[model samples]
Target chain A: MSDTSKKEFKRSFSGYVEICENMPTGMITVRGDLNSRKLKSAFSKVVGATLPKERKVTLAENSIAWMSPDELLIICGYDNVSDLMKKLQKELDDQHHMLVNVSDARAVFEVSGAAMVEIIAKLAPVNVKTLEIGEIRRTHFSQVAAAFWLTSEQRMKLICFSSVADYMFDLLKTSAVVNSKVGEF
Target chain B: MLIFTCPYCGIEADETELTPGGEAHLKRFGPGSSDEEFEGYLFNRENPKGVHFERWRHVYGCGKWFHAARCTLTLEVFGTYSAQTFEPPEEIKERIRAKRPGWKWRNFS
Candidate 1:
């Protein structure tokens, strides 16, 4: 087990986009056959949200993001993770499923500004500017695996493993520096 | 940069985000097999110049293992398929054959 409290750090940078880290989002990693009705019903009931379609993010009482064909990441209030995990385990006791409290294993960051897309584009090979509201993409952020979703046109949330939080933050900071703008082509 | 769409997640990933797993669809030779068969399975491989099947893991995206049919001569990728399959699907082979007529890669014609 990892000490979730160790090495906790938070920082922010000013640039074309404001890059802030350590926003503290609770994450639950669910693994199972996504097509199973039992899995879907149990998950939606506990998490209070609908299952997201392929490569999508759904926001309701809670937010659920499709991580892969057989995996999902649920984002919710940090304090409710234990309670929800207990309920989910009880609801899916007989099914071939895995529900884990991954809240402590990840780092959440927020980027705000009209030019937020430019900061993301600098590190990832993606066009964040055109990302649909409910769309989420899992891709490499320079050298690390990361996922990001749009909260709105000028705001976004990004998450990656806690182990690489510092690296990801620094990378984002460098990309957001005022002079590094990837202006309109 | 070479790109292969992950068959599982439908994400078109570049070579840098993927981990190549050498050859694909190899038969395992267990303890009862002859030394020649074991040696073939352990070390021998077909270094063909065209229409090769290889395994790759989408380490950066969906994290799924899949197979790709690529042309070594031009770095052209025919397509990617699920790694759960026992052999290359007929459609991919047909596409390869269409581009290179009468292509013979190992046991497949």
Candidate 2:
């Protein structure tokens, strides 16, 4: 693969709140009848964790989140996506299911520090103070839609469409600047 | 600025996370129906000022469709329920009755 063709990525800003673009990661969407025992078991086996209910499960290097009633998003190392998808296909062959690798379709950003929640609150309606670790919420950040989950007390992971990544970054920067000014006053 | 709870995801989603799907529980008037019935199904709406039931999609949340019971005049939400059924659940109707006596929307009294 030519390095020049690879899109250059960077974290646009960092200060009281640190923003960093995560390394390329694998994302797979699994859609099926979640009520089916066979499908549920297949998903648990492939992801090495049970399908989370109204929350996300993080195991070592992978995280599985419930995206909808019938859909789940699995995040893992970039190189493991193909193998994981194949394994899921084999395990779910007897059932009706759809698996797609969506790694390149979205961008993930890790935001942390004292002002992280305040910055997120400026962009989305979510009350970061009440959001528990491991809980995930999908809502509009500024004008674009995104999904976010807290990884720690001061850290969160936000995923948004790659097409709107730049717009989202700008919103974050503006929010951070405004928040800093409010703090100074 | 209405907030609705998605029955599937159990999240009290903000209006921004949801998309209005217009009136809920509309009976379809398809083939063999009268012109009046078809027109009513296509265009006619109660647009009531009192208790109303509507459909909403949690587009940014769990992506599930759900029903919301609210008063149009006051914008007070009575309750939210799943959209899988043809009518509001009995519990939701009861709740509405407690808050607004003799409130009638469709079949619910």
Candidate 3:
């Protein structure tokens, strides 16, 4: 194949549900005892947002989400990650924690439109309709482990391991097409 | 597909997101324990058709281990609770009793 053909082909669909891959961003996984005041404050200061409550995502100057009781995922500009990690390490030096740069390990997709919730409902077991505006959920999307968060009333972000990016894209595309056809019928 | 409420995240998770960890509250028979105790702990399991307690992990969700009270025959979930305890909480037993009346499992009334 030509180099042009080898280049990553971004897929998107616009219909009752819109699905598209999001631009790359810095992604970091932080694991520690979030109950500790010092750890919480340092994390909030470094990420520019407090660690969100259980099953929620906090969006402020930066986006920090609660992945688990002891884990948080931070998203920010790709350029800011290195310095951010360094600063966080310094701040948390005395504490027991783990910081991992997972920017290249995952793919992110954004889905929107009027039938967005229904489309996601087809793939995941979550009741996306009841998912609060800022809530996030970690679940499987058609057999692939995935997580999603509502970024706006009409938009949500889905993320999964990069190894299955193509599979995730295909599943979302198929679901969108099937849903749009159902609307027509 | 079973739905379980994760105690740590306080969110309902589908069976796909949760990994079943087998029967909960198994007493470990470690060093100095009798061979019979070790064998029972390692191999024997209470496979009840009615009310049963099992371990589940919200691996894809909050990554916490929890306990679920379920009926194996009917596939009806009684309730889910934290995995920290050695036995199902009193409240969960009470709920199961209210639903299954005259149920008997282990020592839980």
| Model 2 chain A lowest lDDT segment of ten | A176-185
Give the local distance difference test score of model 1: 0.86
TM-score of chain A of each: 0.90, 0.89, 0.89
Give one digit per residue, the lDDT tens place, for model 2 in A1-185: 33522654455577668777765679999899978999778866877877787656454566888888888899998889999999999999988899999998888888887667877777898766678888888889978999998888888889999888888877777776633634421
Local distance difference test values of all predictions, in order: 0.86, 0.83, 0.84
lDDT string for model 2 (B1-109, tens) is: 7887788888778888899999999999999999999999999987787999999999988888889999998888989988889998888888888899988876667
Candidate 2 stretches with Cα past 4 Å from truth are A1-9, A178-185
The CA lDDT at B38 in model 1 is: 99
Q: How well is candidate 1 docked (DockQ)?
A: 0.59
lDDT per residue for candidate 3 within A1-185, as digits (tens), equals 23433334256866568888865668989999989998878976877777788778888767888898889889887678888999999999999999999988988899988667776778888876578888888888988989998888778998899899989988888888743455421
Residue pairs with colliding backbones in model 1 are none
Judging by TM-score, tell me the better candidate of 2 and 3: 2
Chain B superposition TM-score per model: 0.96, 0.94, 0.94
TM-score on alpha carbons, each prediction: 0.93, 0.93, 0.91
Pick out the ten consecutive residues of candidate 3 chain A with the lowest summed lDDT.
A1-10
